[model samples]
Target: MNPKSCLNCGHKISDEFCAHCGQKTDTARITLQSLIKSDILGSIWHIEARFFRTLKHVLFGPGRMAMNYISGKRTRYYNLFSLLLILFGFNVLTLHFYLNLNPDEISEGNSNILEFFSKYSKTILFVIIPMLGTNAYFIFKRIKLNIAEHFIIGTVSLLGILIIFLFNDMVSLVGLWKPAAKIFGILDKASFVLFILFPAVTYWNAFKKSYSKPGLLWRVSVLYVLMGIESLAIITVLYRVF
Candidate 1:
């Protein structure tokens, strides 16, 4: 084959792509079709590293993923805070559909907790973040992670819980039928177990990823207990004060 002169530069190219300069030999001038197909879709989906790839990394290695993102190598995964906000909206919306609870029912139900959440969603954010993060900070303090990174771990745990909780809600929806309703009582309780277990599992796995050891289970148990206590306390205060 004849060696072609580089179009971008005067360098002679022996291969399809230039060795000195990274331009391809067959590269064409910029065009609308290439721009729309390659640049636009590539930018939107991040075709190099898809969302599910990122989700897997986040799930399997929550601490590492958060550390990579916090340390500025963020392009491989979704933005943790932004993802929490979006998934939170999906979770709340899914709950609304399943419960079929109207605004009045939410307000006038047995307790004002639902109403408080509706009106003060941001407030709940503040409460949950601190409660979860504080517990993690106390438990994981020996590792030398700062408070903000602890919050990232907290968000990862919450995100895991919310994702599985939404799946539970969908399961209950299908189980709402007459025949399925018979088994829903069992599944309903199971869902509650999942609600607790998903976070517990992820939180433990996160710290486990951070510090590899078998004996961290006891510390995570205490952290989970403290998280549950803080969550219940906040809900109780909101219930009475609302």
Candidate 2:
């Protein structure tokens, strides 16, 4: 029976919900249909719907994504690591399959396909996260971020920089004219700064629990230098190994 008085506002109501307060007069018991509709299907729908919102938060809000995730507002955005992995996987596959043809064999196609695969497959891209994040953890050690957290920051930073790299890859694969390629080649190389600067900007926004402007700049700059050194070291090592 519908309660004569609403449980929430004590307003007289003959229906399931209180007219004024909108609280239900009866305690709604869970059913399989409701569970499937509201919990299971709704979760997938929400995540799918919020994909661009998550990207916008990462792109426009800087520290907002990390703050929301760390503060247990997971449903407000997508999983940070999950998004990172998807982008990384796509990047890896695109590089390997689509854009990694031998420049020397542009005329003959991949006649030496095995040789190309060997060199490309041995790429040390995995060192990216550890290199950036390790220095971040140490630089921000006063705030006591864990390795995983630094990894998240590094991942987000790389995601930002990867946009440029992906664009560069697309331009390279599209077979631009010689002069155009020369111009973009310079841009492609110059974009390496964004690799470091993106994280510095992100951490500046996020790691502000106890830092003034100058202090934060100093710390993030230190992280940038350290990460840059690590990137150079990794590239040197890869050159030697491959």
Candidate 3:
């Protein structure tokens, strides 16, 4: 039998994959069934599988997951920034649709901290992630992670926090019904507390194996102090601009 030329790179081959470019041997004409099965569903399944796997680690052991990525055990995980962007996009949709949130609706008189946060949560998160990365770099200097690696840890921690935030938003959607309105209000109030607590918990889980309880507490305290300073700086800038 003659060797079949690879449709992708025109290399002659008998194997299942192209040696030159690694395209599959069966590069037949595109059909509806093939497109749906191989292109659409295949891509979705791949992304979904990796996304869930990454979410599991991000939720339960973000620090360790970051460490694993830093140490190069990364194939099992989805791209962190991509996942962050997806969550951020979803948050935007939920804010608009589920919460019926509008920045203009927040009157100047009611532009308190929480209102400010709701108005600018996405911007705040974008600025704060890098600041938190910087804090981690300095605070956990003994861990020997570089600025980028520290940033990865910070991103992973924030991803977990965002997941919690997303869940809260989802449950708050249930609160929209008349019977659950009270519960919704309570959840809305509790979100601020969770926002503060989740990051601290994520960092602790990430670094618990690395630091003693007392040692970790003081470090986390310093981290939060840095975060507060950063938050104040952001708020000041926003207030001046707006």
Among these predictions, the greatest TM-score belongs to 3
Which regions of candidate 1 deviate over 4 angstroms?
Answer: 1-32, 47-49, 70-72, 101-122, 182-188, 209-214
- Cα lDDT for residue 165, candidate 2: 56
Which 10 successive residues of model 1 have the least lDDT summed?
101-110
Clashing pairs in 3: none
Superposed Cα deviation of residue 113, candidate 3 (Å): 6.9
Q: What does the lDDT come to for candidate 3?
A: 0.82
148-191, model 3: which lDDT tens digit per residue? Answer: 88788878877877887787777667776779889887887787
In angstroms, give how far residue 185 of model 2 lies from its true place. Answer: 6.9
Worst 10 residues of 3 by lDDT: 98-107
TM-score for every candidate vs. truth? 0.70, 0.63, 0.81
Q: Write the per-residue lDDT of candidate 2 for residues 1-242, one digit (tens) a residue.
A: 64488756778888768789887667456799978987789878987878767777776656657766766777777676677667666666656554346345344556455454346532545566787778877777887778987777766666665554555556565434566877776766666665446777778778776788888988877877776787678666755665
Best lDDT among the predictions, by candidate number = 3
Q: Which whole-number lDDT from 0 to 100 does residue 119 have in model 3?
A: 74
RMSD of each: 5.8, 8.0, 3.4
| Reference-based lDDT, each prediction | 0.70, 0.68, 0.82
lDDT of 1 by residue, 54-106 (tens): 66776566656665665778777777677777777887787677668333344
TM-score of 1: 0.70
> Of 1 and 2, which scores higher on lDDT?
1
